[model samples]
Target chain A: MAVLTDADIEALGLTLRLATTVTVLLLLLGLPLAWWLAHTRSRWRRPITAVVALPLVLPPTVLGFYLLMLLGPDGAVGRAMAALGLAALPFTFKGLVVASMLYSLPFVVQPLQNAFEAVGNRPLEVAACLRAGPLDRFFSIALPLALPGVLTAAVLGFAHTVGEFGVVLMIGGNIPGQTRVLSMRIYDHVQAGEYHQANVLSLCLLVVSFAALLAMSLLRTRRHSRD
Target chain B: MTDSPHGLEAKLAWRSGALAFDIDLSLPAQGITALFGPSGAGKTSCLRAIAGLEQHASGRVSFGSDVWQDSSHRVFLPPHRRRIGYVFQEPSLFTHRSVVGNLDFGYRRAGRPVHLDRDGLIDRFGLRPLLERRIDNLSGGERQRVSMVQALLSDPALLLFDEPLSALDGAARSDLMGCLESLHATLKVPMVYVSHNVDEVARLADHLVLMEAGHVVAQGNLQETLTRLDLPPALGEAVGTVIDGQVVDYDAHDQLIALEFVGGRLWLPYRHESVGQRLRCRIGARDVVLTKAPQEGTSALNQLPCRIVAVADADHPSQVLVQLDAGGSTLLARITRRSWHELALSPGSAVWAQVKAVALGL
Candidate 1:
């Protein structure tokens, strides 16, 4: 076992914060997109879905390269921020959050969209007939019914964000307190020949991810058993 | 009941693909108004249009004086604002919520000013035992009951049922129907009910709207509309007469209620009503037997004097419809061709219509 240290605790906390922040952001951005993707009959839906999924197939390094440019001082986002008198985003915790959100977009969207799709038009129509307006129906009927999908998506996004390396290295630049997430910390420990610390952190990640997956499965099983 | 809006009047027109529907109907707002038609004949579509769930091209839907939809003036109140309660074919309960929570959903959405009489609804629907149960744990009948209660909690101005009893088994369907019948009898809200089942329509509907291919083929009092022979055979086969009768006697030993119809006495199974109470009974054509004379030593309990008014094809190889006059009411008898020939049955033939005691739908 690796001896406990303040640095290790800080690294763990930072990783958790990054993962959580990224997951929340992804959920906020992905929910409406998922709803639209599931319900819309637009001709551009398939192509739009493919574009959203492009990052999943592309190399993580390639994604990180574009993100790096996007957040760089002279790049589009960075320049725009600078023009607004704000600091450029690269090499910061916020940059790491942005990179994690991008890399894990599909993790958030696919589950939510699948959940929305599974909810069909029947319930919504029934709700409408029962005198529920569109917004009311979405919150009261659609959101509650799609809860399992939301949990799965959030967990997957959070876990995937914690496991990211290439994107984090490109944009976050391994700052100890700010951007040294768990996966990057494990990579650093391995490179420095500290196998014990790397094993401990890796074990922690494994246990957490496995627990999340188990909880989701148990919830789904309980739902099916009731039905 | 308060003299608040007592009927539904609407002219709904909508087009989807090659299917275009234009319907004009006025239904008495008190009893069950059945939108009877075959599947895809726009029964559900009409219900949806009334509930404001369907956007019609040029339409006007009004309940009594409240205008729900008017496309000419571009006035359309969405479903929620229209205050119409709708129960779908499927229960469509929220699986994530417990039964109580699911029921509370609509109650809450009804806003702060209008509160549901939850205890009353729960008692009426027999939902107390299942109140805390999860929706997934309830049976088909139980789920439907909860859905109905949920809709009722919305305090709707009109209740629209889109084949609410179609998904249940025979026993459950009857149980649910009984509950609905009592609810309709007690509540002042008017209901527009949709069903493809003739038996269901016969049992529940006071008014009938017959639809064919997205058009209102006929609409009137249930007995009059159903007896029309011009409709498709499936509908025509189920065509019968509805008569309002009073329970004159209840023979406890025999488990029968001797009902006094317009013509004569008819015995039915004991129902949950007292003597002198009015009840509706549906007698299908197939259940009546026409005899040239009053027969004796038969188990049948009803033999009323009748004069044959018409004979129509029964759509079967060996059967025919014998329309007769029973006092002031019309009665139809479905008899085999062999029997017709044996009796030499024809229009204006005076015969006794013998009905078995059990065949009357009370």
Candidate 2:
């Protein structure tokens, strides 16, 4: 028997695409937010940080349920989209991407924040003294110094989004070739009692997860020895 | 000294959690001005305020005619806008860049001034060979050398140094001092150097500002400031005068160099200085002994005919500080009260000041 059926191959491709889009979007959004969170002394920082970390503790179903409500036809966001003459985002690939971004926000933001904090004020001050303006200092000094954390954030975010099942199942409804990701495909095979297909899909998901984590660890060790 | 009437005029008052001080200064525009004091006396604060580093510094600061800060008018130029190069105790270089990258970091940011002699600076600081090396690969002294060259490449109007050599060891300290002296002679830019090392101040400073407990005790020519008898007790061991003497002759047979200053001639152990070259020497107060008459066949290498200018109580009761005029130059002698009374020394009394050692600064 073929290890992966055509449907399984389609699900794997969909999962990789979804993971890649969410990771890129989250990184772009996370860099600035994480930089502000690292450097700001405002009293609101604590509460904002707590809100970003909520997904880490909230069960995936709970977050997906809230997102489902917010994106449902009767919800405020859904109403705004309708007013803009846009389709609602439930049980669709676009909805899955949105859910995954929210679920993986902390995985990307926390590492970047830690990295920015580690790059103390001295280098920035030196840059300022050297006549470098604010933006130049950030891009030329602080960002380069925090590069390792950026890569680690990417790996963790991509891996975490790939492993997600509950949120994708809730918002995407497991439609073949569209919303059925690798994790949900494994679930579909088990439900149909196809042990061989289920085992093949499950092994694929496990191997991808392991490879990602091993890459992150290797990047971390390399950074440590470089320092 | 070119005596430019307007140099750096600053009246600043700064107060932080652990330290505070108020200073009013009119520094020279064309030489190294050492802000001399003990640690925590607000020397660094003064330097920072001048560089616009102290955000809370209130009062007026003007370099020549450019007003850097005026709290009343709410006119404050940020550090980046102020064309000043500042060097801290630690090199604090950008670790991500190599030495060449760091040297270029400021140079390029400063618009790569066409007048800046990049090749000469790299050659002067001996940085040509180390340009491609990583910052971490440098030794402490080499790092400071790079730091200095990095600051200079920025083409600043004024250079502010905050105890740049206090972090160096003996060998590195001398090496950096030599570099500083050479830079002083080569560059026309004014400098504000903050240091507590008396040797460094005497060797490097043309003008001196003495700070004590966040207050200015005295500010004047370097020799006059050091010769002041009324300085705080904290300046006890640092009391002395610097003199510029000409090298007259060298006795290679006996290994001695004859030096001539106003009102006297002296012989020092030879150190390969050419004749007619000016040698700078620091004679500490504690290194001199006053005698009513010169002793024949004495091992003491120097004796100068000078008159007692004044006398004051030394830091200790048993010792007295005496000021003397050697020809046209100034000298100071710290001696025992018993000797002062035995020799009957007073203003206008003629005497010979027997010197023990003369410190040569790099």
Candidate 3:
């Protein structure tokens, strides 16, 4: 009996592509959102914070269900996309990425928010007096000081997306070479009584999750020691 | 100095936590203008408003021809847009950067023509050796030096210092003060220094603004304002005279130098300053004694024949403050009520004021 097959390799590759795409998109979206959440003195801060933090407490299935409602063909976003000459997101790799982003939103944003908040007003003010404009201050002073937090956010985002199972199962139905990520693949193996294939894939995921956390911790330690 | 084209005029009105600021100020074109007051007296607020650091500060503020802030016209330039450099109470150096990094942070951003000599300033401030060091590794004095060098590197049109030395120990404080006094002779840009320290103010300020409880009690030339009798009652103890003159005579054996001004001459212990260089000193009112005639047997070495200018009540009920004019320079003498009555002194009465050589603050 073969311990692994071509299908398992395809699932691993697909899982990586989905996690990479979602992590990149989350970072791009999360940077500014975290900055605003950290510094804005507006009255909407509490409500918006609560909304960003919703994924932390809400079950992954709950988020996936709501997203499925919103991004399905009859849903608001799905209708808008369809009108703009786009395919419906459900049961596709795109749907998995979209759902994973919502599921891992807090993991990405919270760290970045804490990082930017750690860069308090004094350094920015000092930079301004040195003839740096607002944007210049943000890039040169605020962002660099929050580098560790940024790294933690990126790692957590990538790992959380990789480990996510419920949202991917609900909105992104199992489909080989498309939405059959490692976690869902393991589920399919267990259901089929292919214990050997399941063990190999599950070990891969376990090692990957452990490595991601260890990498984040090691980077944090090196940075603190260097400082 | 009045003919110089640049000056600062500001009217700051704002309210921050637990403090309200309502101050109107006019500073001269050159030399140091000190905003002197106690903590929570709005001295720092006045400097911040002038530098465009306080966003909510309203009313008009103009530096030279540049209108820094005008609420009615909706003209307000932020700190970076205004050519002003600010030094806070504590060194606000970027911790993530090295000393050189902090120095370059402003130099690279400053718009040309910089017109400032970077290496000379670094050398003057003694920051050359610590260029590669991290900010966290620097001592308090060294950090302040870096702050000063960093500010000067930006080539700012105006510099504002907010109690830059209050955080340092005595040795560091005097060392930085030495740098500032040396820098003053060669510095071209106008500066605003805020401090509650009398010695720092007296040593550094050519002009003074006395603040008390969010109000400007008096503002004038350092010499004129310090000798003013009608300053706020809380500042009555600061009543003294500032003298600026040339070192005409130096007796090396006695370690004394004769400082001669338009009015007369007084001697102070020499501190290695060569003759013909100008120096300044402050004489406290309480250090002077009044007598009807000059006494030869007195141990006091500084005696001047001065005509009385004014007599006012001092802070204590038993003492009186007498203003005297030794020709053109003004002097203040604090005497008891009994001495005032026995001498029968009135404005215009001629008398001899005796000041101890050791009492002069050089």
Candidate 4:
């Protein structure tokens, strides 16, 4: 029977908030882009697909290094924010969110794009003949049909964000109560030789991620059976 | 809305890869008009263009004064703004929704106040028991019926049926045709039906538009247009003439409906309909036998006095089309080489045509 301390609870809460924010942002950004990738007949599709999937192949440290520089006070993103009268974002919670979004983008986009492709053009054409506009078709036809893929993408993005350490360390800088997510907290406890606390935090994250994946798989299975 | 009484008018030109097509057509505001053509003749493409689904084209489509599309003027109304219902060959019902939910989708999206008559549509289509079931559990015919009902719920000004019966088996097709005829009779909305089946066209269409190579070669009343011998070979050897009739009597014990035509009476198998209902029956060209005088004691139930207006050779072996005028209504009799020679069939020959009555499309 392991009891969680106040600090441990805060770390779990921060982790959940970070993962949720990143997942929501990914969905908002990924949906239209995925739709375009799935439907466009342009010759540049291969190049665009390769660019979107670049983060999946590149090491996390490489992405973290570039992102850290770009978000620093003197760099491009930070300079743009300053010009807009906003605060610099490097070494902050916002910076960690940005890092997680970039790291988990493929996890969100691939499944959604595949789902959109699998829906084919026939159903959409039928919807069009039934007097459905583009947006109405998406909400009434596309989104509902692609629900399993959306669920898979959301859970994968959140789980991938939870396990992230390199990008957060590079950009978020492990500040207590601000940027120290559960994964970072676990790393700190391990470095200080606090094995029990590290084990507890690791188990919590493992249980949450595992539960999310299990729920997603179960939902998909049920949908298949119904069909 | 445009006040032009013509329900639909379109002049569309489109290029897909190397295939370029141009079509111009206008449909009257009432009755079922069929677009009859072979596959690859742009039948589905024309329907899609009218529905506002195919956008990469230059066209002028106006339905009853509403400018649907005018690419030259850069005016286009999206599909949602075009009040049309479409039923595809595949049914295409939403798999995620139950039968009731699918029907409600169209009902809700229609938005404006409409006399939907939802219960009546369900009962007419025999969909009451299947309403609560998920779409995945339905048979092919059930799915198509639900699809038709869903389309009707939208209260569309025009309905497009693109081979709605092409995917069904023979029995299902016959059953669905009855439902479609009922819907056509009750609804005031105009319909554009597409099919390559000539028998189906003869049974349902009031007007026929014949397409070949993306062009409408002929268009007129169904009986007149179909009886023409100059039609394309895609129509096959099953060409026939259509006549509208009323059920004069139904002998339930004999399992037949006695239909009253201008020339004579026709007996059809019991079709789930009451006496006095209007019905369309088709007699194929090959089913009639012409005799110089009234035949006595024959197995055929119908022998009507007819005058041979003309005789033309059919493309097939030893067959000639004998055009006849029976009580001011035009009919065609297809006879083989041996029969034509034996009867010495020619123009102005008054004859009695023997019909077996079983070959009628009731």
Better structure of 3 and 4 per lDDT: 3
Per-residue CA lDDT of model 2 for B251-342, tens digit only, reads 88987788788778877767668899877778889888788899898778788889889998999999988999999888988999999988
Q: What is the lDDT of residue B140 in candidate 1?
A: 97
Q: Which stretches in model 2 have alpha-carbon errors above 4 Å?
A: A74-76, A84-86, A170-172, A220-227, B358-362
DockQ of 4: 0.55
Residue-wise C-alpha lDDT for candidate 1, range B52-134, written one tens digit per residue: 76765468888778887888888898877888888988888888789988787767777723446779889989999998898
Kindly indicate the candidate among 1 and 2 with the higher DockQ.
2
Model 4's lDDT to the true fold? 0.84
Top candidate, metric TM-score: 3
Q: Would candidate 2 be rated incorrect, acceptable, medium or high by CAPRI criteria?
A: medium
- List the pairs of residues colliding in candidate 3: none
- The Cα error of candidate 1 at residue A82, in Å, is 3.3
Top-lDDT structure, candidate number: 3
CA lDDT of each prediction against the hidden true structure: 0.84, 0.87, 0.88, 0.84
TM value for model 2: 0.92
Better of 2 and 3 by DockQ: 3
Reference-based lDDT, residue B352, model 1: 95
Can you write out model 4's per-residue Cα lDDT over B124-197, one digit (the tens) per residue? 99999999999889989999999898888887889989999999987789889889877766768888999988
- Model 3 earns a TM-score of 0.94
